[model samples]
Target: MAEIDPDAKRRPASVKELKAMSHPLRVRIIRLCGDHELTNKQLADRLGVDPGTVYYHVRQLVDAGFLEPAEVRTGESGALEKPYRSTGRSWWLSVQLEDLDTSQGFAPVEAFQQELAEAGPASIASYARFALHLSPEDVAELDRRIVAVIDEYVETDTERAHLPAHGGIFLLHRTPD
Candidate 1:
């Protein structure tokens, strides 16, 4: 059974928490564990890393409250194993990077590049990019619309067993003239 923490708090990530989650491997860990709880050994095998490395990052995520222990079970060796599940904080994270040093923001960009490099062009479902000049209000409105579409699609989808997992990156920034 999935463990539910009645006191699980959902709030914007603090700088400390963000830093904890800033590493690309950590982000991948969270994504891998999104649907199901996994042991460190399982995560390590999937991520192609050592279990010790995965365990280190998992501890950071659990400490940051972005993951929680789901259940304990027997492994192939008949030893106890603890699995963890995502807290869903990444889905609703609100980060204000204005006053903070934003070096950590590049983690996602790097992850995106790595995924594309691995998947190559053959696995791509869709790709599109647009360059637009607009006022601040127009930019805000566009952002809202984009987010709405993403949220609607994410929320409405219930049958994922037959669907392929998709990765998307939505980037909006003012270009230097």
Candidate 2:
């Protein structure tokens, strides 16, 4: 949840994709896609939302190219459901850091970035709940290194899956920052 590295040569998320993710349900979909490819039912159940709503968001993410159809599975109704995988663990907005007014382009990307920064505590707390076995010092160093990687690999190329998905390691040093 640290500030994204501005000079990391990261590719920025497009306005359309950022807008698609601004929706709360769609954000959950992206998180769900972090692991295994999931059908709408699984996502809806996990998110505590209606299947119809989940279906709509999944379609939107797919259309925006944030989610990809990894497989197809049939339900009890014999309806074919498309299981989706998240294209990336996270996204970085590329709007100018000093741009106060976003009247033209990438406003949604900027907005999402601001929203995430404001919710930093929640991110930190949630990240803390994950299980990781290691000594204190080693864990701290691991956190620093993983964050550097995630922060550095901010470039997101929708044209190709250059970054590995479903693989992330977070470490918290517990030292004052």
Candidate 3:
């Protein structure tokens, strides 16, 4: 499940790409594509939308350069289908509340903060699925393992074709190293 681009490079998203991803469905679509390249039909099946709807969203993402063509496969019926991937591992949308204050004032800021707080919990939970009871020594060992593993991922400048089933680990732990 590890999402490996094999060719990942730190390419920042342009302003246009960021704007296109601002939509909630489009954002989710990007995340899903990050995990694996998929066709519009596959995405629609997974998202429970009609294939046409998924195709439209996918095209918009493609136009913004966030989505790249990955593969072309021939269907059993002889039609060629295209698979698409997200070019970057993640995206950030930066909104300067300070800048907005001069124009829109504080309500927009508060609303933005509230939405982030509400959305964060589920995103966190979806990503975290393990709990361990450990002694101090065990905790230290875990930390070592995590750091070593993370280092392994980052040590190489370029990623590979397939990541491990571990889904490209993002280890977060606070302990004395």
Candidate 4:
């Protein structure tokens, strides 16, 4: 088993950053940039939006440290274009669950919807759902284990070059009896 990267740091995102990412478009933009670098114009074209809108969102993401400047290249119009890429770090936020239920709550679902629309339902290879009861300690341990597994895959650098972009989400919560 590989150990966690010593240099890898997981810091809680600031409120400003979280607010910036609360928008579904921003979430989709981050997901789109996950595997490869892209310019605002490319992202705009992919989402069928204007370059100005993409530029605004890209600037917000870049300012939040979720995206970084990748390169500058000439576009089809022979003008220089700036590209950006995801930082490849999962954000850690300590907000109360109630807070997330606000505007940020549906962002992930929207992002998933956008991806499904792009890839089509036929592209999905696997899907599963489960519900289980456990003690508080067990719940904590289970969460840790699941996160470790996800982190292992998330940190894959070399192999990711050949792999396509994928998204996975795990939601755990206890319901009142």
- The runs of at least 3 residues in candidate 2 whose Cα sits more than 4 Å from the true structure, single-residue gaps closed, are 1-9, 74-79, 89-177
lDDT of 4: 0.76
Structure candidate 1, residue pairs in collision = none
For candidate 1, the 10 contiguous residues with the lowest summed lDDT are 1-10
Encode model 4's per-residue lDDT on 62-167: one tens digit a residue: 8888889987888889999889998854344333445565678778778778878888888887887777889989986776677667767765655766766567
Model 4 clash count equals: 0
Candidate 3 has an lDDT of 0.61
| Model 1 error, position 155 (Å) | 2.4
Ranking by lDDT: 1, 4, 2, 3
What Cα-based lDDT does every candidate model obtain?
A: 0.77, 0.62, 0.61, 0.76
What would the TM-scores of all predictions be?
0.83, 0.51, 0.48, 0.82
Give the deviation of candidate 4 from the true structure as CA RMSD: 3.0
- By summed lDDT, the worst window of 10 consecutive residues in model 4 runs over 3-12
What residue pairs clash in candidate 2, if any at all?
A: 11-155, 143-171
What would the per-residue lDDT of candidate 1 be over residues 42-140, giving only the tens digit for each residue? Answer: 998887889999999999999987889988998899999999998877766665556335657777777777767867888788888779989989987
Residue 158, candidate 3: alpha-carbon lDDT: 45
